[model samples]
Target: MNLRNIQYPFLFEVPVLKHMAGFAGLLKRDPRGWPSDRPVVGMFLCLDPLIFCCQPQPRPFGVAHHLATRFPDETFVFLVPITMSLERRVNALALAAQHRRFQKTHPRASLIILANTRDEERLLRRLGVDVRYAPQNMFVDEGMYHPIPGRERRFDAIYNAQLAPFKRHELARTLPSCAYVTKMFTTWSPQLKRQHLGKFVCSLPYNHVILNDVTADDVVPMDHVKVNRAMASAHVGLCLSGLEGAMYASIEYLLAGLPVVSTRSRGGRDVFFHPDTTLIVDDDPRAVQDGVVAMKARALPPDYVRATTLRLIAEERAHFNVFIDGLRGRQVDRTDPRWSFEYAHKLARFGSISEFEALVRAR
Candidate 1:
C-alpha cells in the first residue's frame, strides 16, 4: 500500500500560510496520549459503548488508522464531513492507504463516514470510503437553542459567525436591519465597521463573546442561551460563507425559529433547510437584502420552523442508531435507542479538543 502509487493533488497540504496557521493551532493543543499529528475528536456517541468520532483531516485521518489497530473492536470510527470540498476524499484516501497496511492481518475495515450531502456520499463511496448520509449539523443540541415566545424582533436579520474575512460580512451590508452576533478575534470588528457598517443601523448590535458578564476577552464564545436570544432578536438568520463545513449557525437559526437567507454555499447547511423556511439568494448585498425582506414578509411561524427542524434532525439520529445497531447486532442501547446520541452536544464541538484524549483515555 505505497501511497505514492495513488497520486492525487494534496491541494490543501501546501501553501505556507495554511500550514503555519495549522501548526500554530496544534501548538495550543494538549498533546497527552496522542501526538500533535493525531486528529482531535469531534464527538463520540458513547465512550462506554465505544463509538469514536474521527476528525477527517489529511494528517489526522492517517492517525485514525493507527487507532484502529490498538482498539480494533473498540475503535469504531465514525467520520463526519468537516468541509464540502475535494479535500475530504483526499484525506479519506490517506486513511484507506494507511489502514490497508494492516488489512491482511486485521481482516476487517473499521472506517465509516457520515456524509453531509448526496454528493459527499457519492464521491466518498466512489473512492471506496464507507460513507453514510448523516449531516453533522443534525447532532446539534436542540435543548440549548429554541425560539423564545414573543421575544422582540428588533432587526430584520442576524448573522452569527466569527468576524473573519472568509465570512464576507460585506454581503450582508445592504440589509436595512441586521444584527451581528459575532466572536471578535481581536481588531476584526474595527475593520468590519469601517468597510461594512456605514449607515447600517444594527451594525455590531450584540457582542456576547464573553460569558458570565466578562468583557475582557471577545475570543470566548457566548453562552448558548444568550446566542439563542440574539437569534430570536431578529426575523431571519444569514449564512454568508461560500465554502466551509456544515454551518452550525444556520441550524441554530432554524431552531430559534427564524427563517434563513443564505448565499449559495458549498457546505451541507442545506441538509436541514426547508425551501419555504430557507431562501438561497445570490452572493450579493442586494440579493441578500431582498432575501431578508422576502423572508420577513413571508412571516413563517416560529413554532413551525422549530418543530420541522427538530423532526429532520431526529431522522438523521435514527439513521445513526440503525447503523450502529446493525454493526453490534443489537440496538445502541437496549433501553434507549438514541442512547449513543445522548452524549452532550458540546462534545461534538472541537473547542474542547485538547481535553478529548484525556476523557477517552479515562474511559
Candidate 2:
C-alpha cells in the first residue's frame, strides 16, 4: 500500500532559535506559540521491499531520500513515523542522512523533518538534523466520546475487536448481561477473514451480542467524547486484539477513568499497566470473567486513575514533541542531563540496552 496516500499535516516548523535567545538554553524553555500556517503534510512511505522479517532495511534509505527531496517541491511536509525499538535511532539517522545529503545537493527544497518516538528524537539530535516531534496522531481524545450522565447504561462491558479461532476459543462462552461488541463488517485480514465469518455465524443464542464492525454505518465506536463517557458509565472496557500498536482504546479507557480488561496483546503490554488502570489477563475465559467481576466490585478512584493515565500520556507526548523538533532542524540539548543522549550513546556504542541491563541485573 502507498503510505503517502494516508497523508497527515506536517508540523512544528518554527525554529527553536527564533523562540529563545540561545540554542543551548532553548531546552529549558517551553514553546508558547505555533505557526498559523501549517504547511507540511506528514507522509509515511511504505517500503515493504525495504523490510526484512518485519524490520526495515537500509535499502529503503535511497527511496526515503528521493521522497523527502521531492515532497517539498509539491509544498507538502513529509514525515516518517516508525515504531519505537532499539534499531529505531539507527534507522532514523540513516534516513536523516539521506535527507541531509539531498538538501545539500538541492538547497532550495522545502524539506521539514518529523519523527514520533523517543529513540527517533535522540537519533535526530545525534545526527544534528533539523527534526521535530508530533503527538503520535492518536485520535483518542476523551472530549469527543464521553459518557452521558444521568442516563442509565444497559451494557456492562463492551468488547470490540476481531473474532478469530483463538479469540473465540478464549471467549466462546459469554458473561451474563455484558454487551458483546463485535464488528458488523469484516475487514481485509487474510488470516482471520474466514475465521471471523465462521465465528459470527456460530455466535448466536449465547449472550447479548452487539455484532457491528467499524465499517457498519449504524454502529459508531465511541468517538473521543463518547469514549470518556463510556469509561465512566461502563463497568469495564475490554479489548482482546490479537495484535496492536499503542492501542488507542486503552488510552481512551484510561482517560475515561474506566478500568480496561485486555489480553496480553503486543503493543497493549507496552502501554497498559496491570491493576493500575488496566487488568492484563491471558486469553483465558475464567481470568477475564474474574477480572471483570473484580472491576465491577470495586473500581479505582476516578481522579487517581485519570491523573495517572494523563501523566503517562504527557510524558509520551513530550518525548514525541522533542523528536519532531529534532527532525525540523532543532536538535535536543546534549548539555541537559535529562536528555536521552546517554541512552542513545549507550545503545549505539554497546549494541543493545536490554542485553546490557540484563547482564547488570545478573550481577
Candidate 3:
C-alpha cells in the first residue's frame, strides 16, 4: 500500500510524523497495504477533527472529506483508542450519525474499531453500526515497543500515562524506585498559561510528578525511542487508571516483557491481563501497593510475555484481514478467531455492579 495515497493529517509536523512513522512501519508489513488489489479500507487513527483544525496545514481533514465525497463507495474505518465515557459517548453518537449519512449516500462498508468490551459493542450495535474489537489495544505498534536484548531493567517500576485525575498518578507517587512519564495536551493560546497553572494546581502535594507536555502546538515531540527505552528499562509497568479502553502504557510494558501492576481497566485490557501476566487489583491504594509487592515477588518469564504479546498482535492482524475480506464480498468464516466473543465477559465482570443491577431490574 502506498501510504502516500492516504494523506496523513499531520504529515508536515515533524513530531507527529515521527510517531506516525512507527505506526506506518507496522502497516507496511500488513498484507493489505495501500493501493491494494482488494477494495481500499481507509482507516483513520483518530476521529477528532479538531486535531486537524488546529494544524496550520490541515490537509488530512480535507483528504478525508474528499474521500467521503469523491469515493463514496470506498470502505472506511475509524479507530477510537480511548474508551467512550458518557461525554465521549455523546460525541461518538454524533460522529456515528455523520458516518451513517455518508453511508446513505454511497452505501459502501464502514466500521468503527473499538476495544473488545460488550458495553461499547452493544452500544454501537444498538445504534445500527458495524463495529469490531481488537483483543488488545490494536494501535500499539510491535515494532516500536518490543524487548531490547541486553538492556538491563534498571527501574523496579514505571508509570507511563497522562497526569489526569483518572490516571491516579498519586498511587505511583508512593511506589519505590518508579519512573513517571506523561504527555499533556492543550491548545496554544493565551489561556495556555491558565492550563499549565490548572495542571500545577491539580498535581499539588504530589508535585514531583513531572509532565512532558506534547500540546497541539509543537512544544515537545513524542519521542518513541526515548519512551520505549524507558519502558524497556523498567521491570514492571504500573497503570492505576480508574477506567480505560485499553491502557496503552500497560500493553507497552507487557510488550517490553515487563509484568504489569494494573487496576481493573474497564475495557479490552482483560483480554490479556491473565493470572500469569498481570497483577490486577481494585482502585484502593492499599490494594495497589500490595499488588506492586506481589508483582515484584513474581518471576514472570520475559520470553513468555514477549511471545504472548506477539500472539496478540498476530490475532489483531487476522481480525483486520477478516474485516477487509468481508469488505471485498468474499465468503469468510464467521466462527474464525476474529469473531469469538469468549472474552466479552471479562469486561462485563469488571463493570459497575450498580449499572448491571439497574439493567437487570429494567428488564
Candidate 4:
C-alpha cells in the first residue's frame, strides 16, 4: 500500500505483527536499521498541509524516508527527536543512516526536528538534521490530567513507562511502594500480555498497583482518564529512562499534580520540571528511592506543582508558537485555549485516527 494514500500513519502495517515491533525479541533481525515497521505513533500525509509525525523512539522502519521520497517537493516536516545519549538499543548510527536517506531522497523537503533539550538539539545538528528546542510535553492535555482532590496518595511512586529495557524498570525495583501503570504490547493477545505482565509483576518487590493487568483480572491498558486517576493516587511519579524521547509520563505526572523523581539522562523529559516539586537523581536504585522519599516528605501542595509546571509548559509552547508562526507566515493563535491543537498529545493517547480527530472536534 502507498504510504502517500495513508493519511494516518498509525495504520501503517508491516508484513506481520511479529516483525512489527522491534522490542521484546519479537523481530528475528536487528531493528536498529528499522525499528517498528507498524505505525506505532501519529503521522499525517497530505498534499496541502505541512506533513507531521509525533515519532517515538526506535524509528519506524524507513517510514520517514518513504514520506520524504513520496511527498511533494519542499514538504515541511516536524519531528520530536528521542533523547538517546546512551542506550545500546537506540543505535544513533542507524538513526543517522535512515534520516540521511530521508534528506537525500527528498532534498527539497525541509524537516525540522524538535528537541526537548539543547543537548538533543546539538546532537541532531551534529547528525546534519535541522533541530529546534521545544519540549513536546508542552502540548499534554491538562484537562485530562489535573489533580483529583479527594484521592489519597497510595503508591509512593508510579512509573508510566512502557515495559522496555531502555525505560530501565530495574532501577525502580527497590522502591518500597511503587506502581507500574505500564503498557507492554497492550495491542497483542491477552494471553501474551498476561504471561509477560504476570512475570514482571511477580518480579517487582513492592508494586502497590499494576495497570493493564490481565494477571489479576481482564483489564486492558487504561485510557487517559484512568491513567490520570492512577497517577493521582500516587505521591510521586517516576522517569527511570536513561534515554528516550520526551518521556510523556514526566509531564503527565506533573499535570496530574504529582511531584516527580527522575534519573538524570538525555531526552528532555525534564524540560517542564518544577524545581521545587521535582528531583533529578543518579541512575541508581538507592538514589531514585531516596529522591522519591524526599519529594514525598516535602508534602508539596498538588495545586502548586500543577500550576508551576503549566507555566513552564506554557513558556515552551509560546516559544514554539513564535517559531511555527514564522514558518506559516502568519500567527495561528496557537496559545488560545480553544485552539484545536491545544491537546495534540492525543496523537499518542488515542489508538485510532478517528478517535483523535473526534476529540479535536469536541474541543
Candidate 5:
C-alpha cells in the first residue's frame, strides 16, 4: 500500500490530491495489479481498475483524457456520471461524439462505466457509442444505517443533505415540522466565503423555518454516526433534490427503516422507489405536504426495507466485480444465469486487443 514512490506526473499540481491520497493508497493495495511505483499511472494501465471519475468535471476529464492519450497502449476504465438529458452547461451530443472518436481511434484503450441507466445508454448510442449500464456505487455501510428496534422516533421528519442550491434546502421552509440537518459552511477560506456570500445568504432562510411550534435550530453539520442516530429517531426522511445521481440520503433513510418522501430524483433512485416504501411527489409545497401525510399514515415493513438494502448492496458488489473482471482481461462465465448480456458484450467489445489475440492462440 506504500505509494510514496508513486508518480502522478500530471496530477502532482492538483490541490485535491492531498485529500485523495488515502483513498489512492487503498487502491494501490488492491489485488488488481495497480502500479507500485506509479500508482496513478498504474490505475490507467491496470486490468479493470475502478476509477471514480466524479461529476464529469472539466479538470478530471481533461486529466483522464491526457493519460489515455499519452499511454495509448494501456486500458483506462472510468465510472462516469452520465447526464440523463442535456443541460444548459452540458453538451451531450458533443460529449458522446468525443467518446466515439476516442473509442474509434484508440479502440480498447478506454471503457466507460455509466452511473445512470438505460436513458444514458440510449443517449450515448444516438451519439454513436453504445454505452452499457453499471450499478451506481450507492451502497451504505449496513452497520451504520441499520434500524434500532427500540429507538424512539423523536422527529416528525428529517432532511439529510448538504445546504446546497441543487438540494433545494429552501423546501424546508414549507415543511414546518421537519428538522433540517445541513453543513454551516462549504469552506473556511474568508476570500471564498466573500465570493459565495450570496449563496450563503440565500440558504439562511431555511434556518428561520418554524418547526414544532418553535423556530428550529440553525442547521448543524454532524458526523455520519450522529446523522444516522438522528435518522434512526425520525419518522420519515425528505429528499427535495431537483436532480440526483443516486440520492444517497434517500437510500440512507430507507436503510434506516424510515419511509422516504422524495421528489422525482431523476436518476438511480427510481430503481429503489416503491409505493410500499416511498412517497414520490412533485416539487410543490402542497404536494410534498400531502405526500408526507400519506407516508406517515402508511405502514412500511422494516424487514422489507432491510431486505431491499441488502439486495442493492449485493447487486452493486456483483456488478462492480463484473466491471473489474472485464478490465482484467478475465473471461466472465457466459453460461452463468446471473451474467448480463450487455455486460458480456461490453467486456468482449472493449477488451484489450492483445488479450483477444492471446485467446485466439489458446483456442
Candidate 6:
C-alpha cells in the first residue's frame, strides 16, 4: 500500500473528520517536524521581517519567527529587508543561517527568498539563489469601511496608524488644517503626549480613537467603532508610519474611496505606485500637507481603487497557489522527523492555518 498517497477529503467536505483524526492521536503524541504521515511536497520557511527592537515585520511572516525555532521539518520562504538598518541586516543573516542549517539537516528542505526591496533581490542572487520580491498586501473588511450617504459631516479625515515618536511628529507637520482621527490616545509618556498636543493644537482636531491613555492597549471598543465610522464620513485617509509592511489602514482608506496621504516608505511604495491610488509624501510635513490638499481637490474613483485592491489580492492568491504547486519538489524520507505541536502553533501564527491544519489531519 502507498501509505503516503492516502486521499483524504477536504476539511470542509466532512468537518467531523478532524475530530475523528484527533481521537486517533489521543493515545500516542505525534513527533516533531514530520508529524504528518501523509505526503508533503515541500515546506515553506517564513523569514522575519521586523528587525527594529529585535522584532520582525508584520507581514510576510507576521510574528512567526519565534515559532520557527520549534519546527525544523518544513523549508522556509523568507521576506528579506532591502536597505535595512545595520541591526536588521545582521538579524536577516542570522535567520538565513538558521534556515540554511535546517536544509543541511534535512536535505529535502530548501530556501526560497522573497525580499522587500529590489536591491535585496540582487543581493540574494549574488549570494547564489534567485530570490523573488513579494510585495505586501493590505486587506480590509469591506463592510466596515463603506461610506454611508448622510453621515458625511461626522469626520474630515482618518489617520489610523501607530503612535510612535516619528509618526506623531509627521502628523503634526503634515495635517495642519486636517482634523486627525487616531486609534491611540495618551498611552505614551506624559512628555510624548504633550509633544503631540503642542504640534497639532491649532492646525488639527485630535480625536482619540481610544479614550483612556494607559488602557489604550487593553481594549479600544470606542476607537474601533470610531475608525469604522470615520471611514464612512471622512473625505480623506492618512497614514504616516515611518516603518511599515503593507499598511492595512491605507488599504481600508483606499477601499473606502478616501484618498490617502501616505509616507513614501518601502512598505507603502508598491501600493501607492498603482494608478491613481494614493498621494505619496516624504517624511517632511510640507510634503504631507501638499498631498492632503491634492487629495481634497480630487479623489480617485471608487471603482478604480476597488479594482486595484482586488487585483493585488488576486495576485497574492495566485502566488500562494503557485507556491503550493511546487511542494512536490521536496525529497521526502519517511524516517525523517515529523512536525510537533509547536510547529502547528508556528504555522497558525503566520496565517498558514489551513496548511497547519492539513498537517494535523495528515497524522
Instruction: Give the range of the ten consecutive residues with the poorest summed lDDT in model 6.
Output: 46-55
TM-score of 5: 0.63
Score candidate 1 by lDDT.
0.64
Superposed Cα deviation of residue 34, candidate 4 (Å):
17
lDDT of 3 at 125: 67
Please name the candidate that would achieve the greatest TM-score relative to the true structure: 4
Candidate 1, residue 29: lDDT: 22
Question: Any runs in candidate 1 off by more than 4 Å, and if so which?
Answer: 1-49, 55-59, 62-84, 87-109, 184-220, 332-341, 346-363
Give the C-alpha miss distance for residue 323 in model 5, angstroms: 5.3
Off by over 4 Å in 2: 1-77, 82-139, 162-169, 182-198, 211-233, 268-274, 301-304, 329-363
lDDT of each: 0.64, 0.44, 0.52, 0.64, 0.53, 0.45
Among all windows of 10 consecutive residues in model 3, the one with the lowest summed lDDT is 50-59
**Model 5, stretches more than 4 Å misplaced?**
1-63, 66-71, 83-90, 97-108, 137-139, 184-221, 312-363
* C-alpha root-mean-square deviation, each candidate: 8.0, 17.1, 15.2, 8.7, 11.7, 16.2
Model 2 worst lDDT window (10 residues)? 46-55
**In candidate 1, which residue pairs get closer than 3 Å at backbone N, Cα or C atoms, i.e. clash?**
none
Tens-digit lDDT string for candidate 6 (1-363): 222212221111234442243222223321234332322222233222211111133322222332333344544443332222111233344434543543455453344554554555555565554355654332234445555545654444566654434344345343543444443333344554454444433333454232223331322334445666667666677777554455566667766666677776643335434546676777776777777778777756655666666666566545633443344443323331222111221122333434543442354
Q: Give the alpha carbon lDDT tens digit for every residue of 94-184 in model 3.
A: 5356446545654553434343566766766677655565444554565677777778876667788754445676676555566667654
lDDT string, candidate 1, 1-363, tens digits: 323211211212233443234232222221225553444546665565556666554343423454555555554544544443433444445534443443543454455666677776787677676667778787777888888997899888888886455677778776667777766444334544333223232343343121223233333467887889888889999999776668789999999899999998865888888887899999899999899999999989998999888878888887767776665555444454444455657334453444555655788
Q: Which stretches of candidate 3 lie over 4 Å from their true place?
A: 1-64, 72-92, 108-115, 188-222, 330-363
Q: TM-score for each prediction? A: 0.71, 0.51, 0.63, 0.73, 0.63, 0.57
Off by over 4 Å in 4: 1-51, 54-74, 78-90, 186-196, 216-219, 333-343, 346-363
Instruction: Give candidate 6's whole-model lDDT.
Output: 0.45
The digit string of per-residue lDDT tens for model 4 on 1-363 reads: 543312212223223431223332222221333322343455542223464555543443323444444434545564544543312223444455555665675677666666667776666677776777766777677888899998987788898987645677878887888887876643545555565556666787855567654545234577898899899888999998765667778888898889999998766777787679799999899999899889989998889999998888777666766675566556444455533233355334323434433333343
What are the clash counts of all predictions, listed in order? 0, 38, 2, 0, 0, 19
